[model samples]
Target: MQMHQTARNDLLLDVRNLETHFFGEDSVTRALGGISFQVKKGETLGVVGESGCGKSVTALSILRLLPKVSARTVGGEVRFHGRDLLDLSDREMRKIRGDQIAMIFQEPMTSLNPVYTVGRQIAEAVQIHTKASRSAAMKKAEEMLRLVRIADPERRVNNYPHEMSGGMRQRAMIAMALACSPELLIADEPTTALDVTIQAQILRLIVDLKERTGTAVMFITHDLGVVAETCQRVIVMYAGRIVEQANVIDLFARPAHPYTQGLMRSVPDRRRGRQRRLPEIPGIVPSLREPIVGCSFAPRCPFAIDICREKRPPFLDVGSSHAAACWRAEEVMGA
Candidate 1:
């Protein structure tokens, strides 16, 4: 198979050959192994993978938040607005963080400071990024709470994170993330801990806010259902590398990569039949203690060939802006 270039479009954030490694006592684990993707202005790039697939690491690398003393970005470049984030000084990176880019973490309980009231937490972000006075910031925090569809914003703002329910805490986190009007928002499983009804509400709130603010979002989740509802484009990661990427509709309609196919097949479809059992991918995800020598998914891939055991496959364009990294690309396409 030959490499094909997809149509070039304006990109808001571009990550190229990103490699984040964590040094342990006996071995160095490669958390992210040369992963690359881009997010366009007013677009949501949904990154989906099983747990421990380097999804969260990619997010932290972009923000330069990984502990540099032990965790190192040994290679690659992360460019935001044409500036290389890896080259930026700590002070410079701090300015970009929360101002140009913001993150809504998975668990609001752990992400939020327990001692601070929700209003004060949001206000701190506002005051740090914008030249808002304490009173003004507090007022804006209340407005932000209202914008996120939280009822009784004035009362909620004064409550600490532990005082609110799970759904309310998630909303407060969203309010705080959007306090500075960031151009890019990285939502790392923001709805994971919420109930079904609240999850849908939060997803809709994110969509509405993005439409209003024109903020580019990197939404990371293990749920394909969430991707279907929230994303425009989807990137499927496996064992630290992107295995498949396509528009949301195309990805669901025709997943070219075997791993992606397995993921789609695994989603429970109760409408199919009462006897339908969810398909599961067998075997465990490979440890990244050492450099991967071959196609990372080869061990679990149903169609893997001999060549797949010895060599890593380059990402090949399947069709219509879709790409997949697999040695048996032709087999996947039935060529």
Candidate 2:
């Protein structure tokens, strides 16, 4: 998030005031509420928040992958390469997806076609995007599998989704996403399903692959540990909006938002005795179905003042390139 001598052209993706809602028979659920951020070219940007905080929804919204029947993005612009993605025709959008901006979904089993070999799926993407010959695309697929460090690319490419282990499947997913070498890679909880050891391996693999490919990444996860290991910049979302955005190091060292402080406190502290219960944020997340009168996190924030409960706070500058939507960021950071 550091903007030291940063130019506007350095941005690979620029999202402005994005808002997404899901409509039901009775009421509408506000999934994303005017959240905005940027991803610099070749930098790994992490979006971390608790479940239902619009982390996944942000990714989906950016890709235009949300369910059409229910979810709708009512406002805002998703700009990539100086073009507004929301205004693109479906055909144009299709061409851009997987070629210009690719996404690796959370669950490989659900995403990977059960009927097709892993190789075919990857080759299909290459073929569709690049229009390469079947043989050439298959060759590219094999090369991608090798790139992701999948053992025996020759044999593994022919294996079905079920045939590969969880880690392998996730790797294959990454390979498919990177097959065409997209400029922006959106990985939505890519390591959520894998075991701890496998999770570490996957995280390492993503970092290595991003460096090798020079691809910018939007990594969405609930784990701050993953963010610390992989991201240069971090966006902390709460109640459908970004509460704080800062460099990963600064975010950990001085969390200016009370919600961010609460989240950090919830992380297990090795220095603390085992008998000490993990700290938690005090109140339930505000319901998004109804209108939020003030700061959505004020109900749970320990530093809330009268104005925090009466009127929403604007994003205040905590430092260079660090901002938080909090009335008492100074007190929160010192606390």
Candidate 3:
């Protein structure tokens, strides 16, 4: 995988020092802990991490959709098109959401309304964002469904969500997301609930849509293979913070963070001779209730040193547009 230079001026969204916290029974859980990254126009940025690593939370924060009573965006900035989304009013944010930014969630069954026909759902989005009438919106919805490669979209649009298969439902969700031709799309584990074949189809559809619409995407998932196939760059997160950021090729070839290396090794490879057991990263993720004293990954990092345990590592630039937050990044690369 050869690294290519991304057009720096094409950056569409830049998130800086974002922090989202949840108030629980007795403590506050920091879901997004000072995370930062950028998604360029017409490029896909994949975010990979284990469950509960703030992948979904980060996506929700960008839309300002977190439950206000229990969760709040504590700090940081989410800039889209040189405007800070955090400063926008609720009404303004609502207009931006689904019009400028749309999201395709992991589960289409739950995300889609059970009582409404797929066509009606997509038409609703179109009508809300654009000045299209009922008949016009429905026509646009049908076109979008066909665009997502759904067969007999006109008929399918009339069918309720429960009548469609998991794959078809996912495609319907995608059609709804693209109803307004949004500038940015956030897909959180879009294919997680589907089979392998369906997952591949969904990934291909997203790539095709990006190529055709020049829509920037923030694809959140734990599957590295999917990232390799779909994303231009990768952001590795752990304990709510981004630990490494690099172009897809470089990150896969020479991962900078020890935790990232561990994750790569843990992926089962048939090329390797049969092993007694798959590799596993030791230790559980640290509790986010209390403020972390040092690097959150230090507890599980095999090459962690005294310095790593005593202080948080700054995101160090290793090369052009490649960076990692690890004290022993060089040593990890060597290994």
The lDDT for every candidate, in the order shown, is 0.90, 0.93, 0.92
User: Which stretches of candidate 1 lie above 4 Å from their native place?
Assistant: 1-9, 333-335
Question: Against the hidden reference, what TM-scores do the models get?
Answer: 0.95, 0.97, 0.96
- Which tens-of-lDDT digit does each residue in 80-161 have in candidate 1? 8767899999999999999989999989999999999999999999999889999999999999999998899999999999
Determine the C-alpha RMSD for candidate 3 after optimal superposition of all C-alphas. Answer: 3.7
- Model 3 agreement with the true structure over 139-256: per-residue lDDT tens digits: 9999999999999987888999999999999999999998898999999999988999999999999999999998989999999999999999999999899999999999999999
Among the numbered candidates, top TM-score falls to 2
Q: Spell out the clash pairs found in candidate 2.
A: none
Deviation from native of the Cα of residue 255 in model 3, angstroms: 0.3
List candidate 3 stretches off by more than 4 Å: 1-9
Each candidate structure's count of clashing pairs: 0, 0, 0
- Give the per-residue lDDT digits (tens) of candidate 2, residues 40-134: 99999999999899999999898899999999999999989878899999899999999999999889999999999999999999999986999
Evaluation by TM-score, superior candidate among 1 and 3: 3
**Best candidate (score: lDDT):** 2
- lDDT for position 219 in model 3: 97
Worst 10 residues of 2 by lDDT: 1-10
